[model samples]
Target: MYFIGELKGSSPDLKISLYKWNSKFFVKFETPDLEQVYKISEMDVSEDEIREMVNEEFIEKIITRFKEMYQDLGELMGDY
Candidate 1:
């Protein structure tokens, strides 16, 4: 994978990286203890569109999902 660049809207605590490998584009979002990744076909969307897609609302949703993931993991670990 080739490292492209990070999202401008990403916060210091949350790093978002963009990568391109073969015919697919990979977007990776990482927090201190958790991460989320998504793949997109290069033919499906342009690089510029990816930037547009990751707006404030999108970032909010990602944050919400990260919270949910942390909660779920905590609960799972508690059970263990």
Candidate 2:
């Protein structure tokens, strides 16, 4: 129910967390590659709300973005 940090690589690495409370879900984003963690954002929503809002097209778009970002990161890290 959360869209934590996006994965951008051959394997997706997520820097996000999800929490549930009272049948509602919350997502939290964390800083990448640090000894200490910092929150970037948070959102609360219900399962039905998510199912209604997020569809296949939206998910595909996200996957594309992650792939692009992952490739870019790999290049930067000289690991590709």
Candidate 3:
């Protein structure tokens, strides 16, 4: 895999890694215990465009979910 780009300081506490393998693009998001991968292909659109869209939308949703999960864990542990 070749490094494409990274979105850092764009989200709260997470960083997104973008990679390319041949004709496919990979979006990776990692935390302490979880790693998420999203694949993009050149179907009707260029891979570059898809990568941009994933950065704007998919990564946002993943960060939101991570925040929600962290909050839930804190509440469960009575850290409120």
Q: Choose the strongest candidate by lDDT.
A: 1
Tens-digit lDDT string for candidate 3 (1-80): 99878854345456678788867778788787556787876454575676557645666688788788777778988954
Q: Write down the RMSD of all candidates, one decimal each.
A: 0.8, 8.6, 4.4
Tens digit of per-residue lDDT, candidate 2, span 1-80:
43433222212333434445445455333334321122322255444454444445654555566567667778988963
Instruction: Go through the candidates in order and give the clash count of each.
Output: 0, 1, 0
What are the clashing pairs of model 1?
none
TM-score of 3: 0.58
* Candidates ranked, most accurate by TM-score first: 1, 3, 2
Best by TM-score: 1
Off by over 4 Å in 3: 8-12, 55-57, 67-80
TM-score of the candidate numbered 2? 0.43
Clashes of 3: 0
* TM-score, every prediction: 0.94, 0.43, 0.58
* lDDT for each residue of candidate 1 in 3-43, tens digit (9 for 90 to 100): 99998677888998889999888888999999999899999
- Global lDDT scores for all candidate models: 0.90, 0.43, 0.71
Model 3 residue pairs with clashes:
none
